[model samples]
Target: MSRTESVDKGHGRIEVRQYRLSTDIDWLRELHPEWKNLGSIVAIDSERLIGDTTT
Candidate 1:
């Protein structure tokens, strides 16, 4: 199990982001031969106070 955390404080607001990854999924390499030595792939967006503000 792996965990990560990030925090940003500015613009009169505070933002925090967290992530978790797991490699317990079986039959991962069989389905995708490109992913060797990799259990899985995960992607996450940004969590911020600014959203479409154009600032």
Candidate 2:
């Protein structure tokens, strides 16, 4: 099954892996140089936003 995840941009940082299929990782990396590491998986929206929180 397809999976989705969100990586919060802490403070001035930027989101991490698991972005939209159209998103370009290289571009994102250039945009946020502060974030040396990828953020944690925030959610998996089963085709859409499921709720307000995730495990």
Top-lDDT structure, candidate number: 1
lDDT of 1 by residue, 6-55 (tens): 88888766576777776765677877777777856554445766655422
- In candidate 1, which residue ranges exceed 4 Å CA deviation? 27-38, 41-55
Displacement of residue 5 (Cα, Å) in model 1 is 0.6
- The TM-scores of all predictions, comma-separated, are 0.49, 0.26
The candidate maximizing TM-score is 1
Model 1's alpha-carbon lDDT is 0.67
TM-score of 2: 0.26
Encode model 2's per-residue lDDT on 1-55: one tens digit a residue: 2355766545444444453343235555667787546443233233222243333
lDDT of candidate 2 at residue 45, scale 0 to 100: 33
Supply candidate 2's per-residue lDDT for 3.
50
